[model samples]
Target: MKEQIRCAVLGLGRLGYWHAENLATRVKGATLVYVADPFEKQAEKVARELNIGKSTKNPNEVFEDPTIDAVIIATPTSTHAEMIQLAAKHKKHIFVEKPLTHDLQEAVQVIQTIKENNIFCQVGFMRRFDSAYMEAHNRIQAGDIGTPLYFKGVSRDPGSPPAEFIKNSGGIFLDMSIHDYDISRYLLGSEVTSISAHGNILFHSFMEPYHDVDQAIAYLTFDSGAAADIEASRNAFYGYDIRGEVIGSEGSIQIGSLRHHDIQILTKSGSTHDIVPAFPERFKNAYLNEIEHYIDCLRNNEKPSVDEMDGKIALEIALSAKKSFETGRKVLLSNPTLSLD
Candidate 1:
């Protein structure tokens, strides 16, 4: 028989609420025990909607709850490290949404604390769980793609965030393109060795306060002597266009397209198809799969497939890209090799 894991959802914002609802209604072998957020009303609303027994405005209370076995942290970027450290100290397992910590040193410290406390920590890198990306990963590991040599990735949002939000988002590389960094590594099975990047404030000038650009392109060199080219944009009015392809010695694998539906209309004008306008819609299944994987790992006493170390390494790449953009020279990475064990 599987043990039921008692869980708490931290941060009642968009992604936080999504996790809470899933834990309450979708996930099995897990019970939603509590919901916490800085906003008491939002927490109460989400808790009520999920029919959870408890709701609080304070996240620390969730960590202090002996009945809670694990916590899903959907908190703001600024609070991630503190929450992670606290959860580890309280001997609770954790599943935190990505860019583990805005500060690299903080990220390293959080991982060390989890290790010292023997707590299981899962970092959310949802793309790794996406079926298309999973198929690509499996094929590369199986040698079907044969000696993967190069990669190309594109991640564009339908619109930009408010200026106030961007100001605290740690810049475009850390805030957004970090996913591309992870996707590149997940596909190539190698670490980034160096990076060079260029940016343009092609659309939103409000990002100036944070030194964030609306559009940027970066080229990454990997440990296996492979390279990846990635471009990210805060505004892609055509929809949330995200796609990637890996070119290997033998063949290649491509994933994603502008998708809302499969059908396309054709006529004298041309072919027309709907485009997915948001990340949530496009990667909904992936997010669910990742959260479920975390709960299953707790039940089975197994380590997460993608853990804190994966998050740290991806952040390192994003940091390097940022420095490269600032200096106009390739920034060599000094990241310690990430261990999957």
Candidate 2:
């Protein structure tokens, strides 16, 4: 029998909690060894529920444990680099959530350390594991769309995040549109050569102190003569509608439909309507499927669907978009092989 992979998850917040729970209940050949969070109460609660082997406020305990083979970092954006460095020092495989780090320089450092350690590192670009998105990607690559020319992606939520979260969100483009950046690259199969963007705090004026923009639209031109338009908003009244369309020379492919066949029509003086809730319902399977893929990769000793380079490239595009937004001009992405400094 194969040995079980011992895993520790850092952070017990919303997303982290989900990671712990899913690993505990769904992942085969994986054991939940430890959980860490600054909030002791939250950590204790999850520890008891999942029957985790250990719980603590300091993540170092998990890092120091020789038995723990891997660490899943779901911590805040700022702490990712430090945690990744520590994990590498311990010779533990790492799976970190997106954006890598808040600053580009720090992101570069993190990648370098991982390379030096020669440990596997995966980034949480979960959407790539989703079935719907995978279908779209395969179709585009198969030339079903015949030399993709343009792509459009929309990611909108029903409401803005809390004021505190907005303060640390690194604006709408970095925090939210980063996903679209990855998806754009996936569908277009080209590096983003240049980007231009327009953003404003139109919906969430109260978040002005944080310089948070609630709405942003970015245009990306790829090296293959393909282009992509990404629109992101935090105040879509209908629901959390995320959809994409790939337009090529032959035809177009649209993924995700708001209307399901289960919708019932009621005839009351010729009136009918459909029910639409928030994002928690729309993308639930995508979230679960992502965790499953991570666990499978760990068990098989195979690389994850998304790796550190994908995360860095996504962050680079996002940072470029922010620069374009601020300067009112297009910003070009430097070659990945070239040193930015």
lDDT of 2: 0.84
Task: Give candidate 1 misplaced runs (Cα > 4 Å).
Answer: 338-341
Model 2 ranges with Cα > 4 A deviation: 259-264, 269-276, 337-341
Residue-wise C-alpha lDDT for candidate 2, range 1-341, written one tens digit per residue: 33588899999887798889888888777898999999988888999999997999999999999999889999988789999999999998898888777788888888888889888888888778767788999998888979999989998877898997778778888888999899888888888999999988777888888877888999999988999999999988776778889899999989766643346576867755453466556656676787667667777878777888888888888988999998999998767424534
lDDT of 1 by residue, 291-329 (tens): 899999999999999889888888888888999999999
Q: After superposition, how far is residue 33 of candidate 1 from its true place, in Å?
A: 0.7
Local error of candidate 2 at residue 58 (angstroms)? 0.8
Error of 1 at 32 (Å): 0.7
- State, as a TM-score between 0 and 1, how close model 1 is to the true structure: 0.97
Which predicted model would earn the best lDDT? 1
